[model samples]
Target: MRELITKYKPVIKFIVLFLGAYLLLSVAYGGYLKVSSHYGYTPDFITDLVANQSSWLINAAGYKAQVIPHDAKPQMKLIVDGNYLANIIEGCNAMSIIVLFIAFVIAFAQKLKKTVLFILGGSLLIYIVNIVRIAILAIALYKYPEHQSILHSVVFPGIIYGMVFLLWMLWIKMIKKSAT
Candidate 1:
C-alpha cells in the first residue's frame, strides 16, 4: 500500500487539488447565484452580462439584435432581426467552464505569480470566446433554424471546449519548460 501510494503520489495530489478547487469555486458561484436571485436579478448578473455582450456583438456585425429577460424563466431571450433566436441561460455564461479551467490549472500549478496570472487571463479569454460563440451561434441559428440541433449541440460546444483543451495543452507546456 505504501509503495503504491508513493508511486502515485503526484496523481493523487493532482486529483485532490483539482476536486477541492472545483468544489470550492462551485459553491462560491452557487452562493453568488442565490444572492443575485434574492436581489432581483432574473437571469443572474453574469448570464445577463453575457447575453447583453452577445447581443452587442451580433448587432455590431450588422444584425439587429437584442436580449430581454425571459418572462417564463431565469434566462434571457435573444432576438436577432426581430426573430426569437435562443435563450441565454446561466449555463451559457461560461463561468462553469472557467471554474473547470481554474481547477485543472490549480492541479498542475507552478509558480504562484504565473499560476494566478494564467488563471485570470485564461478565464477572461474563455469568457470572451463564449460571448462570441453565443453571438455567432445566434446568427447561425437565425440564418439556418433547421440546423439548430447540430449548431447548438455540437459545433458551438466543440469550439469552446476545443479552445479550453488548447489552453490546457499550452499550460502544460509552460509548466514543463519552467521545470527544465
Candidate 2:
C-alpha cells in the first residue's frame, strides 16, 4: 500500500485537494442558498428576474414583449408581440450552472486574489449570457415553435455550457501562464 501510494503521490494529492475544495465551496454555496431563500430569494425570484430581463431585451429588439406570471408554480409566461412564446422556469435561471462553474474554479484554484477575481468576473459573464440566451430563446420559440425541442434541449443548453467551458479553459490557461 505504501509503495502504491508513493508511486501516485502527485495524483493522490490532486484528488484530495480537488475533492476538499469542491466539498467546502459547495457547502458554502448551500449555506448561501439557504440565506437567500430566507430573504425571499427563492427559485421564483431568480426565474422571475430572468424572465423580466428577457422581456426587456426582446422589447429592445423591436418586439413587444411582456412577462406574466402563470397561474401555477414559479414560472412566467413570455409574451412576444402579444403571442405566448413559452414559460420561464427556475431551471432556466442558470444558478445551477454558476454553482458548477464556481465548483470547478475552486477545484483548480490559483492565487487567492486571482481566483476570487476570476470567480466574480466569470459569474457575471455567466449571468449576462444566460439573460441573453433566454431572450434569444424566447424569440426563437415565438418564431419557430416547432423547433422547441431542438432549441431548448440542444441549442440553448449548448450555448450556456459552451460559454462555461470556454471560461474554464481560459482560466486554466491564465493560471498556467502565471505559473499558478
* TM-score, per-candidate, Cα-based: 0.99, 0.85
Point to the candidate with the largest lDDT.
Answer: 1
TM-score of 2: 0.85
Output the lDDT of residue 134, model 1: 99
lDDT of 2 at 160: 98
Error of 1 at 5 (Å): 1.1
Per-residue lDDT of candidate 2, residues 1-180 (tens digit) = 999999998678767776776677668766765676576543457777888888999999989999888875557888999898888877888877887888788777888999999999999999999999998988898889999999989999999999999999999899789984
- CA deviation > 4 Å runs, candidate 1: none
In model 1, the Cα lDDT at residue 64 comes to 97
Itemize residue pairs with steric clashes in candidate 2.
Answer: none
